[model samples]
Target: MRLLLKKKSVVLAVLLLVGGLYLINHSDFLMAGLSRSPEIHPSELTWQGQLLVSKESWVDRGQYLPLNVSYQLLAGAPATEQRYLSIGISSVNRKKGSYLISTLQSIFSMSSSEERSSMVVVVLLADFDTGWRMATLKDIKTTFALELEQGQLVVIHVPLEFYPPITGLKRNYNDAPERVTFRSKQNLDYAFLIHYCAGLGQYYLQLEDDISCAKNFLSSIRNRVAEQEKQKVTWATLEFSVLGYIGKLYKSGHLPLLARFLFLFYQEMPCDWLLTHFKLVMTQKATILFKPSLFQHMGTFSSFQGRHNKLKDKDFDDGFYTNPVAEVFSNISTYQKNFPNLAWDAGEAFFWGLSPVKGSYLTVVFKEPAVVTWIFVETGSGTKDLLQSAQVELGHDVVTTGKDKSCKDFQSVGAIENGKFEMQEVDKKYSSASKCLRILVTATQKHWVIIRKIRVTTKQSAPRQE
Candidate 1:
């Protein structure tokens, strides 16, 4: 009886052990599901169909005037030692010249008076006739009377008769088939204007006649400029709008080269296409592009007949789903702390550093794993250890530490501009399951590196696994 009882006890112990092991393994699988957050795949936040571009040009520019003699100075902005200049080019043949009014109006409405006051709004008159241009100038003088008198409004007339004729521009109309619609001449027009206003101020803004702007665009420009200086990266241009060549900003110093480049390639490609290619000609890649596009393309009418303006019907919505700035970055590796803290948002000051030992970086952590589309890094102008080179890496399934931790594991951002900030748009969106973005300051030499602003734009979505 004792033997039987002992055997029963042994059997009971074995059964209990097996039951405990089973529960342990199964519970862990169930718990994992409960803890996991819903994954919003990057694929889900994408566009379908052919991508679109906005190409608006004055179709009648070729038949009319000489750019040189025609570049008549209608009005000049009051000179007050302004640091920047916003240029708006108005051509002939468009309706009402309402773009001139709207561009200036938007500037006044969104930016501070001081900023508006400092900007020189040069409206180029490339109309079909002198009468039309004169009439339009009269309308502008009357409408922007205050600005005109204050030296904030400038109107220039570049009539066909006096301006230089389209000469020396080599072309492959087949490249930009739109050349059939006089798109090549339109390209030349932009080249001339950009060259014309090349060194008018410390900075030149490429403002179009038929584009609308976001609120605080001026502030955005100013902030970006300041950040670039603070961040200490050598940059070339600050691109405001992603649609075509509407709101492109350039360093006055680089204008001559850029303008000349446009001159050489005017006939080969559209102005918008020229912008990206032009960057490659010089920097091997395009400069920083502002996300959530500060300026939107609103023109529905195509400047080139038969080619309708398709910016309105983009296959996907390209607005920024994430804010350019965040309150604080989570799981930062290390940062330089001093007066004037790092600016994570667009308007803030910047993050400055000096003698950062090897492997120092500014990290941006998100609440959940996300797909990052862009990272805008603006460096400040300081002499010590300026960020000469850098690399950006995305982390997935990581906590404070991340996988793929080497600079080689990341991508190299192109050359930094001298005494300015550089913006790098990811060619392809990066998905991070760990929800962290690591910007490794992999290279810096001499002087302090000032990162005035580091903006990480992300979509709060990720792909989940079984």
Candidate 2:
């Protein structure tokens, strides 16, 4: 009887120990896996006041910050008891549409102040397919107006179509559900949004329905903008598309004149595409903030222009020059004939190519005599090879130089073990008072390539003659 009792006690103790271990492991999995929670070090955290400077504190170039600034957290506790901004999402879907929202929520939940100040996820509706979209939209205004805790700013996402009519503006919807046609109406919408946001906050972020903010997107944008602003970049476009070769334009040194003519004569092309190309030619760098106002001003839908097609009589109209491709080519040809040394790549037909001016994110600083640098990150071993094979040339005459130009050859600096090749000081020369530099990379034995990132840095003075 004593032996039997001892056996029973041993079995019970073992069962209890196993159960405790299982619970501990499960708890860790929940916190690390399902929650996707960011780790917070309580000891390392500190609070800082919001940073704001006067417009005059920066330069007066065309650069200006948005008018709305604030954010909120729909979930999670205040990691630190610091005053910060708030951004809220008014809708969430649980069905197929929810995938994006869920992903967004996950990203927001994991975001850090080092990335974004603060963010909130207001689940206005659980299922968007259940006819709750309209109701969700309607409630955003009241939710936004709700006073936040002290020391916090609130930024609301208010749908523009639901708002009341503003006096003195006429709305046109000729391009409904397909294209953006009414320039005045689009501008008016932006004006109203800006004005409304101005009353509520210091900076406004107007995101489109399709855009998915990356975890570090806000932080990246803020840091990039702050750096550019410090350098006094008046006009910045993030994404740049190649128009064509610009050697012809560089030869004539008449890019500004040609661009002016193209802008005036060709008003019908896609503004975003055209502006991006222009940035590539002039600044050799393209950057623009992804915001509703910018979209309204630039985004247009035209099924007639899908991918690349040769210019034809059928495609020509009063807006022929307005088309991004047509306008870009026209400008490229004109600039090429005049400048001749500006080489550009329009990208291949299959590839959408790089945007000279359009950026998924961007910032602008109102300053003068700024410096800019363009950095391109090559991804994939084959892509790096291709980049290495291509030669870059910088010259004053676009029409006269080709692959044989003295400043066209690129030398390999080093190869990254991760399949990337580094090239530095490929071609540098001083002509007149302007400095010219070019970098070219091409694949020696591979096809199909990917670029990781392209960085452009602009500086004002010549490094103090050091």
Candidate 3:
């Protein structure tokens, strides 16, 4: 009887030991579940539930501090898998209006289908208003259903408890108390957003909720990054726009460093200022700005109540110039190297010409006729050097005289007003394909003329069916 009792006790002890080992081995996987609360370590941020923070987020700040903040995945799954790029945008409820929806629309609309596939856009709804956050999420889901389904867009929110005390911050810049509080909170918002996006991709891009994207902006950014990589240029930040915190790109591996810097001095300065400081500390002495900015600010009202912001990027190009094969001829005296062809070329430089009198003309004759669909022309970067008055004309039937080619007849399409002219889906007045497009000056002006941009879209007529 004593030997049978001993065997039973030994078997029960062995079974208990095996169960303990199994639970210990799988504890991390179980605790990291989306539904379960995660175990917190004072020195490290746990990858819990929908929060996909990676283990590499451990930063070596002089002293270790616990980050008790947590994020709620409001929409779309976090991109745990690596992507080519990750875009981070933080939005708050504005007093006057909201630009988040428009910003999202512009990003997806401007990016190509393939470009969208290689990147992830993470939107942090950093608003404290629960109702507003819910409404915004619904709007985004409804408007961007396709993008969300394709895993290109992910939306998230931080509960109020996640933020440290925002009020009663030190006024380092001698700013107003409300302004100080606003900037301080903004700092924390960006820090949390940066940290969250650190592990989503190979690179990260920082954008705002109130901006418009240029056409094929993603491709332009990728090309620039590739150029830098090929040249072996060690850079910390690549700027695509000059506007505050608009189009900044960083490497994913370096994001933890950036997030730590932002977290350490979040209360001392605004996010933009901190960005400059961060760049300096990283040993990047010069600001690398890509010309013909890929993004532009579209919001007039500030996120902070009652303050109006009307900033615009002067170098932003909408990628309109799609002129068909043609030869450009202009009678206006060229300014230095700013030739007539430079205006139509797919580049940032524009054509600068001396002051023009009435009847001065610039003409583009296509090698083959096309069904012209769209034409856009912009003059002068500033008010002083504008083409005061001009008329846009479409020419039909080409004729050769001497060594020069000319249009047989020209019909008025539209006139340049306020130094700008744009027409899409032009009414085809002629029955046949058009031969040329022209700009004829109607009024003389004292200031030099700057043909800043000329864009045309054309489609050939379908082959006639026999």
Number of the predicted model whose TM-score against the real structure is largest: 3
- Which lDDT value does model 1 have at 138? 65
lDDT tens digits, residue span 43-112, model 2: 3231221222223212112233322211212222322332222232223332222222222322343345
Clashes of 3: 1
TM-scores for all predictions = 0.49, 0.27, 0.61
Q: Scored by Cα lDDT, where does model 1 land?
A: 0.54
- Report how far residue 43 has shifted in candidate 3, in Å: 34
Q: By the TM-score metric, which is better: model 1 or model 2? A: 1
Give Cα distance to truth, residue 207, candidate 1, Å.
Answer: 1.8
Give me the runs in candidate 3 sitting further than 4 Å from their true place.
Answer: 1-49, 55-66, 320-466
**Across residues 28-131, which tens digit of lDDT does each residue of candidate 3 receive?**
65444223443333232223335455455445233244344567666777655878889999999988777777678668766778999989999988877767
Ten contiguous residues minimizing lDDT sum, candidate 2: 320-329
In order of TM-score, best first, we have 3, 1, 2
- List residue ranges in candidate 2 displaced over 4 A: 1-100, 103-107, 113-190, 199-202, 235-466
Candidate 1 residues lying further than 4 Å off, grouped into runs, are 1-70, 77-82, 95-98, 161-181, 284-286, 312-466
lDDT of 1 by residue, 88-161 (tens): 57565653223455445555555667777667776666554656666666656655687788777766644353
